[model samples]
Target chain A: MRCIIRLTLLEMLKKKILYLTLALTAIFLIFYGIAMNYGYDSLRDAEPLMRIAVSGQFLSMGIYALGFIVSFLSIFASVGSISSEIEQGNYDAILSKPISRYEVVVGRYIGILLVLIPYATFFYLSIIGLNLYFGDGVVANIVTVNILKSLSVLYLLPTLLTSVGLLLSTYLSTMGAGVTLVILYFCGMVGGILEQIGHFITGEAKVVLTSIGITTSLVIPSDIVYRKASSILYTTSSGMNFSADNMLGASIQPSGLMLFYIGFYIIIMVVLSIRKFQIRDL
Target chain B: MMLETYNLTKQFNGKGGFKDVSLSVREGEVFSFLGKNGAGKSTFIRTLLGILYPTSGMGLMLGKPIGDVETRKKIGYLPELFQYHTWLTGYELLYNHGLLYKMKKNEIKARIDEVLKIVGLEGHEHKKIKQYSKGMKQRIGLGSAILSDPLLLFLDEPTSALDPLGRKQVRDIIFKLKNEGKTIFLNTHLLSEVELVSDRVAILDKGEMKKIGTMKELLHSPLMLSVGNCSEKIINELKKIDPLLERVGNDIKMSVERDNDLPKIADSVVKNDGLLYMMKRKENVLEELFINTVGEEDVR
Candidate 1:
């Protein structure tokens, strides 16, 4: 298993896509920093500004950007993990060794996650740096929580994508899996929006629609987790100052329950992937 | 049996797996699996390697049940269409597989060099597989298969894409491995290659094991005799002596029930025929056996 993981990591590191992703994320961060610096210079008022508010907003934006980046990168990285091997007949060569099929799936997931870590860390740190630069050190208190939120998005979102990617790789051809996962990511984002709209309508139909949206989000939780992480970063920086009367509501605060849901969602997806892989012909 | 299958059956999308096929390979012997394209050669190999699950029935490898991971450690496999991660050079690929087999780093290095030399790929170790020719890739594939010094090796068309010399090189390596007391389960359509290297061969057609035995066992036991340029009158006269005598293109083809009857048929053919161009017992010898067992349409 260790050997498998090592081989997988080495193979993934050599992929041109991984370096391209890292370069893109770094470029985004540099531009983001320049934009934030300009925005801070424009706002001259400096009377004990809510550092938490500024930091939270910055971190939220970072989470949102990183979330999408990670999701897209993971989809492209993982779409071919299994399917290409099968198509090119290398799956037989790999599986013919003394390795289990489950190890192959899990090892690939871990390898992909390892490749994504540097980009996630770069984005997370850039958000922290941006907060310190713009908020004039007021963002220091909740750096831990902000980092935690970024880490959660980094860790959990990819886990979710990995599972979905594995499941898709099992059933779809490489290109088909890539396109389907991208579509599913968008659908997940739309589902999150519909849930918010359902809250506004306030009826039995609204309740049903919200329930459906929640269930659909649970099925592919990339968007939901991103939103949750964004909310956490936002509230943490703002010190939870906003009243409950806001249009989005204090109910939008990141819930521990959602984190648990994402955890369980990943477990179930991985289980389904394993089961599907076990029965499917290679 | 070092390896055995009990009525192993597999169906893909409701079609194309062999049914009720039973065969075995004994230890330290070369067993050839003969089949044309889509004759389930790869399907059977994958099942044995545990890459594909058997839809029905069972197989045992190295005296244990097939698909057992522990059992697989003792086995080496060379897939038909070998494709390694293109990023890896030949040496890296071999070293990686050696590591998987738990060889020490230095030992892996040594073995990589050794196997590369044995496969006639000595100086090409640093070259990436993407840059390799098909025949070079095949040598690397064979190199990996033998890297672990496994007790059993499963080679699927080990020389299918090779030049004549390359094919001979592969065949020599196979014979050498067999001489080293390793069990080789080969899947190939090259009858002459199989004849030269295999101690036994099995013919599979439409997912069934139509025949299985040593070349001599198959040939002599089936009691086939091919005679050329024999007249129809002599052929009929031979048929009168032995009911199995039949005309095969102005030649007499007969199935002898016993070995002792071969001489009698030959004597009868010569005595009655105007002349005998050639007369020899055809014991389903590799090519004839393959064509006979797999059928003419399937052989091509």
Candidate 2:
């Protein structure tokens, strides 16, 4: 198991994609910092405008940046975890050793997360640092909350995505798995919106549509978690507002219940993935 | 039996893989699994190594069920078209594999050097696998397989990418391991290599065991025989002795039905005023046996 983890980490670290991701992440942070400074300068005299605009912009940037980073990284990292190796016939060499398939799956997931955590941490810190430098003084408590929320979402969301990716990669070819997961990721993003539109038309029918959307989101949790995390980061002390009508409407900050749902979502996806992989014909 | 399969059948959905294939390989022997491309050679190796599960039936390695983790500890494997992490140097790959086998770091380092030397990859240890040529990668792969001195080693086309000298080097290492009491399960299409190294060989075609036995046993079977040149009239005379006798060009080919009849045939041919060009026993070589049993259509 340790060998699998070591090998996974070593292999991922050498991939050009990892460096590309890191470079993109750094760019996101720099851009966010500049954007926050410009917004802060515009409303420098108005305290309420300064606070709302700066906090809202920083929150939005954090959500977008981290969400995109985690989604992109998870897709790139996990989609080929098994399929590429199997395609290249490298798994033959590994499985021929005294390791079980379960170990390989679990070890690879953890290793990918290990690589992801550092990037997430860097982005989370960059957002908070930019908020302090440009906006109000570092609300250590708020920053801590925001960072914790982002980290949890980072960890839980990718775990779900990685599990889905691993499950797909186990049976499909690399390209097939990759394209399927990308489609799944996008569907998950639109799922909630589709459900709400269904609700506006009918009630009981909406229940079924909502459940379907939730189920789809559970299968690929990137959008669900990202939206939930975005809502949480944007929510202020006043109240949760996701309405497009209110110009001041900020996305709801993820509440305790939302966080728990994300956690449960991640666990269930991981368990399903592990079960599927154990019985898979690798 | 050091390794055995019983009624093992594996079938892919549309296409077939292996079916009710059964054979045994004894300890300290070079057992060659002869098959052409997609002849279930790799599928069998994968099943034995726990890379793939059989649809039905059973196989045992080192007295344990096939693919058993404990059984794998005592086994080593080299895939036919092996791919290693290109970022890793030859030494790192060996070291990493050594660690998986639970070798001490110091022991792994020492074994790394020894195996590198054994595979003739001594100085190139520091070079990344991507930098190595195909033959060099194969040598490195072979080195890793034998790194732990496993009780059993499974090699799939172990010398497919090697030149003559490299192939000889691989064969020598296999032979040395066999002499040291390691059971080797070699899967290869190289019949000459099998004939040169195998104590026993199994011919597989269309996922079935077509033939299995020691080289000598296979050679002495009715499927093989020795013939000497004799006069056409004598060939006609021998036809009286045996209905299977036939003359082709300058030589008389007689199929020996029994071992005792060999001396009689030799004497008759000599007395017939014919020169014996050669009297050599022939068995289907691994390649011929594979084709004959598996059918030529299966060999891509």
Instruction: Give me the runs in candidate 1 sitting further than 4 Å from their true place.
Output: A46-59, A135-143, A196-213, A236-238, A241-251, B220-285
Query: Which portions of model 2 show Cα errors greater than 4 Å?
Result: A137-150, A192-221, A227-255, B221-300
Q: lDDT (CA) for every model shown?
A: 0.77, 0.75
**Model 2: lDDT to the true structure:** 0.75
Q: How close is chain B to the truth by TM-score, in each candidate?
A: 0.81, 0.83
Q: What is the interface RMSD of each candidate, in Å?
A: 1.4, 1.3
The prediction achieving the highest lDDT against the true structure is 1
Clashing pairs in 2: A231-A252, A231-A253, A232-A252, A232-A253, A232-A254
Q: Write the per-residue lDDT of candidate 1 for residues B1-300, one digit (tens) a residue.
A: 789999999888669977777898899999999888898998998888888889889988888888888777788899998888888889889988887777789988878878988899999989989999999999999999989889999999899889999999998999889889999999998878887888988889998888888876776433344555566766676776667655657555666656676667668667865555565655336677678877887666
Error of model 2, residue A54, in angstroms: 5.0
Question: RMSD of each candidate?
Answer: 5.2, 5.0
Cα displacement (Å) at residue B4, model 2:
1.2
Evaluate every candidate with DockQ and list the scores: 0.52, 0.53
